[model samples]
Target: MGDKVVKFEPITHVIFDMDGLLLDTEKVYESIIKKIASKYGKEYTLEVRSELTGRTQVDSAKIAVEKMKLPITIDEYLEQYHPLCREFLQTPDLMPGAEKLVRHLAKHNIPIAIATSGNEWLSKIKTQNHVNLFSEFHHTVYGSSDPEVVNGKPAPDIYLICASRFPDNPSPDKVLVFEDAPNGVEGAYSAGMQVVMIPAPEVEEELKRHATLVLTTMEDFVPETFGLPPYDE
Candidate 1:
């Protein structure tokens, strides 16, 4: 008899969504955005952060400009915030169990990739020298030139692109995605990957619909529970 395919497949590749998922960087990022907006006499709020999550900077700036009625152009907004982004990289913190989870997945020989809405230069700062955690595990990394082209999060373009980048293993179904925001989780779902969410307190309830699995911390990620093999590499 042929081997039966389980309804829920085991994860073979792990595609990580950066920003809120792997790093506790969202609050700082929001702070910087607010700081930049304030210079234009616009009052940005936490609610705006939720709106901007997973969007490209260009798209985000458009929203900010339209909703907040900012007096500045997107270019002017970028000028204010981009420098803050670079400065923010001076300190980086790993999300709970983020390092352990990546190392665990990598130790098992699971191919790892990064899909983010951040620009290449800022993304490198976040992944490479800033935290020193993600640099070790990610085999491939991708970021948009501008957030609008791929529709950013709540769309699958970034995740699909990351899946396509895996030269030796290109199947989207073989991947597990880790996300922390509703947009990111939805993107992973649209990309046809198993999604797990480790959300912050603010968005925990809203994210339930998008996640295949929800946990407070990455420490809960046990391979056996999900029918994945132990770390064997």
Candidate 2:
């Protein structure tokens, strides 16, 4: 028998996760966290990084401090870390193919939003170098500090809020989320949305199964596969 073609639901709106998916700031975060860990005589391991990825700022700080057994309060860690993050986040470049995809979506009139765990202040700093690119997003939901989002990723609150904010108020099932972290995939799935994960090279295969599609980079994303407009030559 010929193989049956798998069909995916049509996506009317799109959401993007910022740190590792849209921008190259994850490495900057890793470097900063590693430096802090070293100062405390601890190694910032990949397992710990995976745990912290896609969480709100306060949640990540709490997890990191507890996981590393660091002798400091979450507020102290943020006080020291934020300054270093602000220094490097200001100049991070867009990830590969991020601009092209975003432009294509905009040209096609797809409603798009950014749902990042980073607070508003940090989000602005991270996108300072690419203001034009960041501006293309119809709206942004800063999960860590946005008053609307009562819970962060892995809880579905942010994604739900992002979809609701769109002018058309798209249904959760009609939204497609692009993410690079397992927690984001889980959150999107919980929100009844399809998620495409473009994980880092070091991310484990086991953690990628939650996504509707898993790719190595945005360059590999085929919009047509998810019922979105295809890129024109």
Candidate 3:
């Protein structure tokens, strides 16, 4: 036998991690983070961003304040950051291939839901302009705001919660997760779900090792590879 044939285990449902994955809101955070860092004579670097990515809002604030030595309490940091987030994040652009893929999945009746580290309020602001697209989701779990989610990404709570809310709670192995952050990938992986990561260019290769698959962008995703319905061209 030349090569052993590996059978594909088709995923029955899908969960999406938002922020840098679905909405192009990471840049908004970057701009604000850099502004505050510069004010404190601190430079917000890629390493710091890597740690904050996929974390809950409170965890992100704590990490930023500590890592950058911002000389501000986490509450104070949020005081300055939240208003700016509300302002700049209102009209966020969709990440490449976001709309097309989501729409295609919804059109094909595939069960899809969003699991985001952001709270419900910020989510509403970010998707204010894309109501039609977001409406297609079976449901959305807000890690920071949902009391049911005791922990955020990297803990598997959010993804598990998202899956449970689906009409028929899909098993871990039957849920395919799409993420753009290492923490989110870890969360999905720890939940025993197959994950496809589309990480930032700055993310190191080692950090991507846990993903079931990795792609440069959502545009590169071929749904049929995971048994998702292929788009009708």
Candidate 4:
């Protein structure tokens, strides 16, 4: 498994997905969607969430509304969502080893950035609790607000847009991505970059195949496998 998970090629830059990869906010968003769907006697199961992961706010709203057969417009669903999301986003919890890995990369002068399916407003809200930590990134590309990110995950738009933003405009192969959504892994792969996926518990096995590396938690990441410096501790 170790051999299978490690891609020994050296990578120059790193891109991270925000919600599930670095922050434990995916669960919060999940609960909110489930709660809303339940009002219409619809179930928001793991399979549904797997499909929605890494999708933009509007995109997720559309799937949820349709999948649940909710008697609400996507706009109405979002209106109810924002308020509940606002409260939880401001109090995000970091995923296992997220801070350690990020800081280590930063300390080594690795160019790192965040690329999220969230809009600017949601990004700001989601990152409020860890302003200092998030500031370590070179920049953050918000999918909804970034004109270059015309398409969300399951498309290469966001990853390609993110890689281009780096100072060197590095080749796709030289950039590595960390994601927690199957769509994110596929998107990064489509962009010609190697991705490390830490998928949601219920994501299907088929989706895991897209990742160059997959781990149960951020804690399992070994930078040396990707030719990045190992943790000093």
| Backbone collisions counted per model | 0, 0, 0, 0
- In order, the Cα lDDT scores of the candidates are 0.75, 0.91, 0.91, 0.89
The reply for model 3, stretches above 4 Å from the true place, is: 1-8
Any idea what lDDT model 3 has? Answer: 0.91
lDDT of 4 by residue, 23-138 (tens): 99888888898878888888998878888889988899998888778999999999999998887678888999999999999999999999899999888877787999999999
List pairs with backbone clashes in candidate 4: none
Weakest ten-residue segment in model 3 by summed lDDT: 1-10
TM-score of each: 0.86, 0.96, 0.95, 0.95
Root-mean-square deviation of Cα positions for candidate 3 versus the true structure, in angstroms: 2.5
lDDT of 2: 0.91
Residue 208 lDDT (model 3): 90
Q: What is the lDDT of residue 222 in candidate 3?
A: 94
The digit string of per-residue lDDT tens for model 2 on 1-233 reads 13634357888999999999998988889999999989989989899999999999999999999999999999999999999987878888889999999999998989999999999998988888789988889999999889989989888999999999999998898999999999999999999999999998988878886788778889988889878888897
Question: For residues 34-113, what per-residue lDDT tens digits would candidate 3 score against the true structure?
Answer: 98889889999999999998999999999999999999999999999899888899898999999999999998899999
- The lDDT leader among the candidates is 3
Q: Rank the candidates by lDDT, best first.
A: 3, 2, 4, 1
Better of 1 and 4 by lDDT: 4
lDDT of 1 by residue, 63-155 (tens): 787778888898887888789889886556777777877777666767788877777878777765544556555554444574333577778
